[model samples]
Target: MSQGSSPTRETSRTDNDGNDADDDNDSALGSDQYSTASITSSTYHYRQLGGRSYPNFRDVDHWEPVDEKQQESFDIRHHIYLMQNNQKLFNAPVQPRCVLDVGTGTGIWALDVADTFPWAEVIGIDLAPIQPPWVPPNCRFEVDDANMNWTFGDGRFNLVHIRDLVGSIRDDEKLYAHAFCSLEPGGWIEHTESFMIIFSDNNSIPEDCVYHDWNRLFDEAGEKTGKSFHLAERIESSMKTAGFRVLGSRKKKVPIGTWPKDPTLNEVGLWNQHRWMEGLDGYGRWLLKYVWSLSDVDIELFFTRTRKALRDKRIHAYELYTTVWAQKPGPGGQ
Candidate 1:
């Protein structure tokens, strides 16, 4: 069934603060399918950076919070997925009985999947309590760090889904191994990520453009922070090393602006632009401050220029969106 057609357990809901408000209850996921150790009570505190709030998980996680800008970007990203893949979730071959969503921002994808497969339990784990309280009965959200040892039992999940965790995960190999061991025999693991590198087929982007400089700085910052943005390019090899049978992978060129001639691509570009515009500060603020030691004013000036560059349709630059899925060996396989 399409994500839009999935039934929501609640018609209206409140914000993350548990306030009574009229909001879409269709935006959350998780139902506590697996058991994890009780998280420390000191997890709810947030750190402020560049006028945005981020989870302070005692140095365990360095991800920004699901603030207004991030929420808008998440919605735009959801739209981009529909325009590109035409589905809320991937087309993995497995029929999941239980699903795990790692780094489940806002719990939107997990919620949609729970509604789509009401029989399967869906759990979303993030560093912050950003998910709405009202959600599908089969879906629930938890605050935890994915880098630590997974507390779930072996073979507990039929499908493990991770998306856009490149800049947040320090050791992807370990994460993949954990995912491989957590899945049932013949279960699937799907990873969807985008690269920081931008490309142009027609050489529209100039050498001296701020976009190129921004990417270079971003890459260097990620390397210094030990969270490389290029991790998506190595997912296939990592999964293979974890004993997963390589299913297949696909890549799509996502434009930075509404410059594509094709209708679908143009729509994709529009959402992508909106995502970047809304997320430029949240994406770079912490990195620039902590890694590069740049002042807040300097970072703001840099992003102001970067946003202008992103709006330049003459550049025709695009980022690569890659989806890779693999399955664990069953009894028949070695």
Candidate 2:
């Protein structure tokens, strides 16, 4: 549990003669270019395209957009999660000794958890290098593709947390199975996601509104991409099939705008609106152009209408957010 005893790794570099170079002397080569540079350790090589940076993975990640807008939206969503959970990091009752954050965008949750539980060692894995270099000593971030094989040893984690990975994962069952196997006996795994489809309680949203059109486009695009936004709704059964015992689940109706009657929900709605507004262009840019095959001018006009609709309090549309947690059975299959 000491700092020195934490996860140790080494970067690999080859000399001009194609021989392995010593880790200590690798930096001594002044002018000679390394024939091969392999990262035996966790490393990130981000690719920039179309004014955005993307992760370098064998299979392209569903979420290819990355910029300041996405980061702001992520931070806003994190705050909203804290607000909904009353500032609790997670719903699991146990005080985990080790934690793994899957798809840790911005590493906000991992950093916060490290601060909350200073005794715990927190590891965050993501495709992008958006996390800051200055972080809590107990917390670390790795650029990894979660869809591939997990490198960590089995049963090494006490808690595994996933958030807002709706359109990123292609196979929920495989991811849950990995989580189930990676967790120690009695360890907990929690997945949080917001269903992308908007809803209304009292027929406040109209069929003619752009909100409906937005939902339809997203649904169609998700279907074509094989990363459905509706995948979060089916995670409970997937987790159960992966051998996790259901602990608890909760669903909250997050308003799309500041149109809620209750004061708390109104605040939540305002935050949610900010998140949507910041992400409006990024969300619609690629999907509309590539998936929906819309022209740039048309896409802009569509989002302009979408923005107006989101601000309309009369629409009264809300998104569904769900958090589900389950525990790996201990000895005797309890």
Candidate 3:
């Protein structure tokens, strides 16, 4: 979504027609389904960098910050998606009895799904132990790394959900393979992601826009980690390789500021702006400090200008969001 003189509202491509909002679920396998590790004081020992909190996980190099401000950004992003999808949790046709949310940052989606389906067992897992201790009776959270071999015993989950974890995943196919193995026959795995690059269809952006170079730096950082920020475009192929038959996929243009003519899109752009303003720094901090070799002053200046550019509604800038859901083969191998 973008800010500037109103160009035509961008249209998204979808293989199957649908309008539904969904959140991700996660679980780390143990003898009892949820991982045996507990969220203790050791897990809470987060490193405070630039006034943002980050996990101390040695296994994976997660770039995003895990502070209260960042969590609020995540919640706002959730509401933006809900508005985009007409408030539906999922488009897949099924009454899920069990759901697994991988990379379930903040655990908001899992809690909502648990409340929506009281009888269902909802589990969420992530590298950080930021999820609240008290949750729905049917919902639980685990602190675990998703890239490691998933031990969630095979054929346990009816639905596996993931969202907004593009640059964090080092191997997309391997992650999908783990999700494929954990799902039951006929179960569904849904993933939602957004392109990191900014786009404007009507030349709304100035020639000196900061976005042109900002996204490239992210790509370079992702390359160092062996993860691709453009994984949204590759979701289906990876899922297909993991033996999943495509169920449906949809795309939407998420606006950056209130630039659109439609009321709903205008609101979406407002939330998107809030998201960028509040969280983009968190999104790029680690990468900038460790990978990009930028000094503190340069990082601050870059972010300041990016924020300024994002607020310019005359730029008409937006990012593309893609949601893909697929099913594993059922009884008799379908």
Candidate 4:
């Protein structure tokens, strides 16, 4: 285990404004780890909010939970992506000697990539330090915020991967720009995000569906917070603007339940159904509470109804996910 490894997962901070004073009083907490670059600790304290544990670092305020249950949700979501992506860790065809996994929840993808390429030095960066210490020798974890100015040095990585950062980033263009700057010229940047809206092909979901209300609230919240749940669709243009040779993008319609007849789609839908049901609380609590101004009881009741709808195989609802990858211009560029 790392020196600062605790059940609480104490980690270094990347304070943006140098103002550590906040409602959490994280500055008063002891620093257990350091960033790879110059990111002074501001409010790097792990927090318990509304009875759920959030990460130590700040990314557009405290939103996600870093508890055991939430960690399991994250890992299961990883499997869903693997099943969706045809068992490939990434589509970027690069033999990376160094790799970076941005927003690496639980570090499962980073660990798997490290195992697949033992010679690669893999680093997983997240606002939370929830990754287990027992990892491949080439793999390590860091607690850093991608929304902040990256200080990981120029031309440092061969592959920079980001996933599942829906409704979190305020300025994704800046984030993509940072990835472009950090990658070696011939390196690749691959990103995946699920659009947080549900769809039905046969109009099975009713017009007055609870999902409609939740999707509306998500839209209102995104407008209020400037973090779009539909961020994945807009990334291709941003990556193109950032000097990446944009490759063909991927779009997958992941079913929410075992509603599909196809054997593969049925298996995916089953796991995806479990994925949402298990992580319901962690998924939308902060957004609904803070942005949509919903009470805890109301949020809980809403989630209960949402889960029922998700389990209704007759609805046949599916979520859309978008993935984009591009190569930096230089020798060995794809």
Candidate 5:
């Protein structure tokens, strides 16, 4: 519906990193969707590894090349419950007619949003183009680079939603700033990311526990890629700094398994547990290669043990974080 053309690929003559040209004609693909394409495109290129493809890390693309069990786990329940509760945060009369879902992996949220609002036009973008063929009348999927110029005019979107981009993006500050500029005055920008570090006043992990070891491994892996797995603390501050007027922030304790006391949470917790276990297959397959100081055997063992722990309920933990919602101050006062 935007009827915009794709950006022409620029020849940067640089390797994956910022350094100058390599022997091969390898360069990152740049987008010219927005006027300031350099910033967005450069940041996007920073994550490309010679264009080598990796399976799903956070359900940001399509279903990963994982076992059927793991893939099914991703489909059973919605991870970003905050997005489903849009009515609580977004003002409905403004009721976003144009929505952009960035890094929409299975395109579930985008599909649901389109179904909920038949009049709204929804576009879901992902790197892999893994979305299902059958979608609502108003929803469509595009295989494009969100880190490039947005392909839409400035102030184009009524609502722009991005979530779980922890493993996918390096510069959260720049990303949010761009999203802020993309919205029309008084438009809404919704972001949902996991804190990854969930806690209870009553529960504490030991320094040398397997959970601790897992944490260390993940942290090292994240640092190597410039992605932060534990970015919950920075979300609010980053949104505010990006010029979003903080509308509301609410934290939910996503349970690890069906072990939570409440029924709804218990179901979600069970799904979460399954997703974590399955993620070993989806994410761990790449970890050994990408993470520093990790051997193939090390990743293999980690995956086996992590899966076993989740299956046995040994690590029935919940991801704790607050989803922050904000608005770009609109032109007219209601």
Candidate 6:
């Protein structure tokens, strides 16, 4: 879930906890669940700026030129796999009357949700206003940060969805609790996030491999900022602490490159690898600013080599964590 966007523009966030090794401080939601020391401000800013080149997530002008290109390549079917699995954890109906999408980048998920349930009102919120203006009749986009004190009424939404937001939320328990507060009784909340694990098996990558180096860079940066890089192990615990009964969870191993046997999964892997390649040098573009010992060139090289190894399929490991449909008990049900 910790990834950078294109050169012209983009936005996203989610902070990790100790269940993973590296934490990118770009989480959009800051909460009282964890200490402020969980993430660094500078690192969060870098992620918001689209890694190194762009510094703002809400840059509408940056994405204005790429709408057509995005619409063409935008594949909702690929995400259906993730969404389907995530939704399975919920006991709710196929379509809820009202839905809220947090950190809705590109409005892809929000738009798809709107299209899937025409009668449902889908409200997608993001810090960057990069979402297109041409959304479905039932879908709407709002430029807002989830971490801030919200202005919504209690028990207003029937369903709330958050995905790949590890770089945007510092405190999982508090953030989910806030989401719980805004949900109507029995409303469902779903979260999908990936953990940055070492991309290796028994022998291909040595301890000094580029993937390991990349892991170290992210780890050190996260520790320095106080954001947990290991939220993978704490998802269920966090949800339970937030007063939501857990429905189910799914864990998948996402290969770094197109090495998977399944064609569709391979395509998804390729998409991820290509994204890393295009923004190769941007991964730690600002390492020098936040990290005193590391240089920008060194950081770029780490990202580049990591990208190469991914393409080479030398490493085939990353954790895909999806927990679906936790809900608050109705009155007297708790």
Cα lDDT tens digits, model 6, 121-237, are 998876544566677789887655565444456898878887755435556787788888888887788776666565545466766677666566666755665455556667778
lDDT of each: 0.75, 0.76, 0.77, 0.78, 0.59, 0.57
Worst 10 residues of 4 by lDDT: 28-37
Overall local distance difference test of candidate 6: 0.57
Off by over 4 Å in 3: 1-41, 332-334
Residues 1-334 of candidate 3 have per-residue lDDT tens digits of 1001111112221211231101012222211122223333444567767887776443345688777788888888889889999997777776879999887778888889999999999988876777776778898876666765676789999899999887777678988888888888999989999988888889897888988877787788778877778789889999999999988999999988999999999999999998999888898777788888889898998898898898786899988999999999987234
Report the CA-based lDDT of candidate 3 relative to the real structure: 0.77
Worst 10 residues of 3 by lDDT: 1-10
Top-scoring candidate (lDDT): 4
Give candidate 4's root-mean-square deviation (CA, Å).
Answer: 4.7
Write one digit per residue (lDDT tens) for candidate 1, span 32-113: 1122323333445466766687765435447455576786787688678767887647868777689999988788899988
| TM-score per candidate, chains pooled | 0.86, 0.85, 0.87, 0.87, 0.75, 0.72
Model 3 TM-score is 0.87
Residue 204 in candidate 5, Cα distance off native in Å? 5.9
How do the residues 236-282 of candidate 4 rate in per-residue lDDT, one tens digit apiece? Answer: 98898889999767999999899899988899999888888878888
Order the candidate numbers by TM-score, best to worst.
4, 3, 1, 2, 5, 6
| Selected candidate, larger TM-score, 1 vs 3 | 3
RMSD of each: 8.8, 7.7, 11.6, 4.7, 7.0, 9.2
Ranking by lDDT: 4, 3, 2, 1, 5, 6
